[model samples]
Target: MATTAISADTSARPAAWPRALLLIGRVALGLVFVVAAYTKLHFNGAWHFSDYYFFFGMAINSYNMVPFWAVELMGRVLPWFEVALGLALISGIALRWVGIVASVLLLAFIGGMARAYVLGLEIVCGCFGNSEKLGPLTLARDGSLLVLALAVTVGAFLIKKRAERVRAVLAARQETVSS
Candidate 1:
């Protein structure tokens, strides 16, 4: 009878491809958010913040799903929030929580778009800016973003677990050797 030995090396570690994929997804999602924020904030050949706000608020109001007060507040705040979230994601900081937040935001956007589509309200999406109309394309894009955010979140947790397991195994081996 032949006995085979299993090597307890880093070869037993988690695969790198999954981490790479996670990084790619994170970066892609981050870029999308940053671009969306930029579009909302940008003014053509001018830097009029109030104009941007008014237009964005109008876009939000066009959905008719929220109160005027809420529209004003969201117009003022949402773009900045998106910028922060996007930068966090790109920097890979606090990825697990960031991913969750990103996913939630995308879900909310999708829900709003869906509602607008169902109600037959031809409104600007207020997503990328006043240019994007609420339609199947907008919904599909948001849905894709939600999927990417979710995958990144799940991958982050899985990677964390794998690292913990690896650490435990290494500690156990060290103790055995000392004994």
Candidate 2:
């Protein structure tokens, strides 16, 4: 039951409106990132705060994938990265590249989860500062977000191609009229 706030005029626009679709995709993905970051940054009240970064480190360490030396660094940086991605996606600047990066990150998360599952390590998701044990549901959620990111990429390309065709057609018409 997800409701998109995209404008209703999308259908009325020209066929080369992949940009419109891309915008919708960006906002959707951006929201997920924002919420994830908020959970870490605002977990405890304004005055009292949870050590989300440290907890996240513990959660990630439970997976036993990342090297010991890198765990702390990653835990500290990941939340900030998610916030950046959220802002970038919502801004619609470099939409295609942002979508690509989001997809790649989602893949990495999914990979980590998959490995943990194989090893019987029921680690917390740590995605939204949640301590719930990981399982198939996490995989499905990440997979769905991946699909949205890819859709934005494909849509943007379609818009670019259509714009090119339109430009070519207009140039041809101008040439014929001048002659």
Highest-scoring model, TM-score: 1
lDDT of model 1, residue 52: 76
Which RMSD values do the candidates have, in order?
Answer: 2.9, 8.3
lDDT of 1 by residue, 1-179 (tens): 11111134545678889999999999999999999988888856565567677888898888888998999999889888999999999999999999999999888888888988999998888898677778888888889889999999999999988888878767766666678
**What C-alpha lDDT values do all the predictions have?**
0.85, 0.76
Candidate that scores best on lDDT? 1
TM-score of 2: 0.81
lDDT of 2: 0.76
Please give the clash total of every predicted structure, in order. 0, 0
What is the Å distance of residue 166 in model 2 from its true position? 2.0
The pairs that clash in candidate 2 are none
